[model samples]
Each structure stands twice: as C-alpha cells, then as structure tokens.
Target: MNDSLTFCKAIEALAANIWPAEITAYLDNWQLRATRGVTKRANSVLAIGEYPQLANWLPHIEQFYADNSLPAIFHISDASPPGLDALLDSHGYALGTPSLVMIANSQDAAAAAAQKLVKRDVAALTAEWVTEADEEWLDAFLRLESYHEELKESYKGICERISDAKGFVKIRKGKHIIAVGTAVVQGEWAGFLNVVVSEAERGQGLGSYLMQALTAWSREHGAARQYLQVVASNTAAVSLYEKLGYQTKYGYHYRIKYDLRPLATS
Candidate 1:
C-alpha cells in the first residue's frame, strides 16, 4: 500500500480500538445488547483486520451469543472481505444505520489563527441557564433539524446531557437562547457537538461566535485538537469549518431510511 493509505489504515485501527470504549462507556447504560450467534442487536463484534475463516466463525459467534444469552451483532465495513455480507445474510444478522467515521486535527496553527471573528455580548450558558426544561432550546433545535433531520434526536440527547453535565456553553437573551454548544475532553483532544443557533439569529453571527467560544474553551482546557462531524452534503457547514481552520482528516459515508426498522433475519 502507499504511505498515505497505510497511515490512514493505522489511524483507523487505532480509532477502532479507542472509539469503541468511548461509545460503550455511554451506550452500555441505556442501549441493549445480546450475545446470541451473530444475529444482530446484541454483542457487536467489530473487525478491523483480516477475516480468513468465514464459515467457521459463525458457530463461534453463535456460541458467544448463546453462552451470554444475548443477541450477536457484527459490525462490518467495506474494508472487510467481500464474503462478509453474504456470510452475515446466511446467518440471519440484520444491519444497522451506517455511521460516518470523521476525524480532525487541532495542531494546525494557521487555521486556528484564521478564526478571528469577534464574539457578541451574549451571556454564557451554565448549568443554571438551562434549568427550566424550556421549549426554547427544543425550538432552536427543531429549526436546525428542518435542514438536517438526522440531527434532531442526537441534538436532543446532547442538550439533555449538557444540562445535566459540565462542559456546555450558551448565549441567551432575556430567557431566549440564541445559541448553544457542548464540548467533551478526551485526553488531549476536545470534541465539539450540538452547536445550534436560533433561526431568527442566524445572520447575526451567533453560530460563528459560539464556535469561537467552544474553540477557546477547548484550548483553555489543554486540548491540542478539536474534532466534529458535519453531514457530507452540508456545503454551508463545510465552508464554515474550513474557514475556522478545521481540515478534513477523513470522510465517512452513511445512508438511512426512517420508515423501516432493521431485521435480524434479513
């Protein structure tokens, strides 16, 4: 393989190991899992390397589920063997919504320094700021959702977590929230998510201001990098992030349909 592809593959492997822990830390609390033989929606076995024994692995996978009394879910990607899809189909494992695997680097100084916009005099969001369980937050999110529906539920979850946890920031005006965002510390890396601005407040630079605020906070907390995901199709967001000094370290593809539920038998 070429050096660039090899380096990317190495990073993907590292991320595969590191990210699963991050997801499990949170998902294990509310999400369900079953170990029964690779049927789906149970124990999710992720493969980041070669897959040699296609046929023999099934019984072992089934045994893993049957032994644990849980359903078995195998997460595979295009990097895997071509036979994986057919094997899963023959074994009755259903597929789930695909996830985008995006990455970013914070070490680029020019990009970070290029973000020179001045912030407005809006109030900072705090634990007490979102105490009312208000609809204003939900409303702003719904407006954003109109443009990207996949974010609707995810934004709700982030808002709820920020309301209950630390690392969330906001700017409000007289009981109305103009902008909101949340950040999380992961070693030397800080991740940003759930940034939203009111529909009426868009052109006023609230979105950019919140971004600068989040970046400043992440830097202050000793983070050497900041990362986030924007839907591949959102040109506006891609432009904004590019202007702010974020580079596309990689891209992940995804597809979704709202009407149909996943089936293990398929």
Candidate 2:
C-alpha cells in the first residue's frame, strides 16, 4: 500500500475474512462486528476509511452490542479518523490492549519454512498441515490456549467461517499435540491467527517449528508476504517474529467500557 492508513485498512480486510464475526454490519465506512464478545478483534467497530460521525451513530452502536450484552469496543489505529480517540476518551471509554502489526517479505517466509524440526531437536516431532481445522485439532488448540468453555463455540465459529485460502498446522510429540496455528492467504498476503504452543512445550523450539509449518502452508497457498498481530507486551513473541525478519508496520489498540445499555423494546 502507498500509505500506512491504506496498508492498515488492507490488513483489516484480510483479518475480517480470517476471523469472521457471527454478525457484521457495514455502517458508513466502519464495520460493526459482534461475535458474542469472544475476542476483541471480532467484537470491535473497525473504524476505517471515514471520519466516523461519533454523535450520529453512538446510540445505535451502543444498543447494537447492548442487545448482545456487551459494551461498545472500538479498534483504534494510526489510521482511525483524527479526534475519534479523543471523543472516546471524553465519553469515558478506557483504553485497552495495544497490539502491533508486524510484517515480513517473501524471503522471510521462505526462510522460516526452511527450518525443519527434524534436524533441530532430539525427539521426533510430527507436523501435520490441513486446509481446515477438524474437531481433534480444535480441541488441542483450545486446550493449549486455555480458552474458557463459554468462548470455545465462538472461536470454533470463527475458524469455520474462514473462506479464503487457509491452512491449519498442528505439531505433535508422540501422541499429544503440542502446538497449533492457522494461516490464511488472501491475494499475496498471508495472515496468522490463534498461534499457540502448549505451556510445557515452550522454550523447546516448537514455536519455531509451528511457524515454519505455517509458513510452508502459506507458501503453498500462494502467499508472498506474512503478517501477524502480537500484543506489544509479549516480548518473547515479538523477539521470535523479529528474528524471522518481521518489522512492526503499524500498531492499534482497543477502546472499551463495559456498560450494557439494553435496547428499548417496542
């Protein structure tokens, strides 16, 4: 993309396909999404393209989430319209998670794909790659991520909703799955989601193996570039990506305040 804002919007579009919401409404240039508040990305208003008329849509936006028993959450970025953050601040929305959007070129993707677990570690690790996540793979991922029971269904729905070129990777040691990751290829861009390595498997190089397998999957699907979102505070993850040649292209955060104002019924 020519500018950061345009690039940011492009990533957001790719993300929508990779992490679909149960309900989506395109109001003006903003995308209002809700997935029962399972994850902030699937629940926030993606403020893109237009200068959101905050006053005009506040009530409707509030009531929309209220119907689902969630507060309004806005995904704010460097591209978000000027003063939007300030208005949210004035309206008492508390700032939330700060995340980074890191990107790597084709060379980096290939380099990661070249790293094979067979040569590095002592134990034999079996890597399996699939076009979609199955029940067994989903169970392993949920357990590794330690996701709540209430949120599992929404997460499963998100995985099922991906319609683009997608791949799911699972790394196993013996019979137990130790890692899970997903990659989606849209045009030349490959975006990663829900990458998790079992707690006991961390620091044993499985994360790198997982990334390599996912990179290979992306390459097979015609992706030439890679992007992933990581919380800025996650130093270990940030370090791993940086070593793979990823650089922070931009950053975004959520602005949220939980006040469930249910819609008025007729």
Candidate 3:
C-alpha cells in the first residue's frame, strides 16, 4: 500500500477507537467487534491485514456473535485481503450497506468558503458541546429510534469512550434544534460521524453548513485533514461533501450472516 492508503487506513483505525465496540476481540489481522447490533460498523469484523487464517477465524467469529445474540458480519474494505469478498460470498454471507470513506484537506478553498458562512452565523447556530450525547442530541439525530433506551445508551457509551479530542455538536435555530454532528480529532486527522439534518429541513443547505462548522471546529483544534463515511446510496450527501472538496478514498461494506436458530421448542 502507498502512503496515502496507509494514512487513510490509520484514520480508519482512529475511527474505530473513537466509536468503540462493547466487545472487541482480535484474531491475527482481523478485528472482531460487537456492540449489540446497534451499528454495523461497530459490530462487524474488520479484516485489517492478510488473513491467511481466515478459515479458522470464521467459525470463531460466528460463535462470538452467536454468543452475543447478534448477526455475524464482516466489514470488507480495500485493506482486506484479496479474494476475501469472494470467499465470504461463497460462505453465504450477504453484502449490506456499501459505504464510502471520503477525505478532504481542511485548508481547501471550497471548504474554507463554507466555513466562513457557518462562522458568520455562529451566534444563531447555538452550538452545544457535550462529551456524551444528551436526550436532545439523541432525539434530533436518532429521531424515532431515540425512544429505544438501549440503543440510546449504546450511542452514549460509544460517544463517551472517545479518548481523543472530540465534540458532539448540536446546532439549534431559535428554540428548535436543526442539525447534529460529531467530530473526533486524532493526530492531524479529524473524522466526522453521524452528521444529520432534520428531515423537515432538507434542501436548505443545512447539511453543508453542518459540515463546514464541523470542519472549522476540527481545523481550529489542529486537524489539517478531515474524513467522513457515507452510505454509497446517499447521493445528496455525497454531492455535498464532493462540493466541499472531499474525494472518495475507499469503499467498504458489511458481509452479514443472519442467525437462523429456532426459538425454543415448547
């Protein structure tokens, strides 16, 4: 792998740290993570290096998730071994949620311009900083799913575990919160996670504004490079990030095997 790819992988590693899994186990080059199925990225196995022991690893991974009552999943990225995807396909693991990892130079002109617009309205935006997400942030971001206490607590635990410089941003307009995002800075790299705009507030460019705000916050705190993950099917978000000068660095997806064990016999 070249220097750029290595750097991107390093950022991904940092991301895994920022959003920690409740249970993490390593087998050679593979990272097996589980977080009660709250999020695929947190739950899936990440093949970080050549896994010559993949055959042995699969059974163990299946049992690990089975023990926890979660699906067995693997996050396959460019960093994974060659033919690993085909290998998983042959094993009956179905692919899910292809996503892109995008990166941008924080000092890029376009990003700088967006930052200016967000800075101009800094007072109106009403930024709330929290180490762990409060009910308000969870309500705005998770929306309908916020009613589930376990999921909300899982999110809170993940956010609170970020040891690096991090910020959970809640941007409000008047009494109503309009946007939410999280930024974690490790070394010169800053990763943005869970950036969402209110469903009723789409097309108003709040997404771009949120990105700029997060990027600005990141850069001010010593991050020169910014990275974010987006589902490949989210064209609107991809376009907005592209307009802000982010380019696709790599793509990854989860290969999932659902547990088919029958419920107890009465």
Best by lDDT: 2
For candidate 1, write residues 172-225 as lDDT tens digits.
656665677666655566666566766776665566667766666666677777
Candidate 2 at residue 133, lDDT? 81
- Which of the two, 1 or 2, has more lDDT? 2
lDDT of 2 by residue, 189-258 (tens): 9999888998887887777778887777787778889999999999999998887778999999999968
Q: Which window of ten consecutive residues has the lowest lDDT sum in model 2?
A: 257-266
Q: Which candidate achieves the best TM-score against the true structure?
A: 2
* Model 2's TM-score against the true structure: 0.92
TM-score of 3: 0.89
Order of all candidates by lDDT, from best down to worst?
A: 2, 3, 1
For each candidate in turn, the TM-score is 0.54, 0.92, 0.89
User: Model 1: which residue pairs collide?
Assistant: 34-42, 34-70, 34-71, 35-65, 35-70, 35-71, 36-65, 36-70, 37-62, 125-170
Give candidate 2 regions above 4 Å deviation: 53-55, 112-119, 260-266
* lDDT of the candidates, in the order given: 0.49, 0.82, 0.79
* lDDT for residue 27 in candidate 2, whole number 0-100: 79
C-alpha-based local distance difference test score of model 2: 0.82
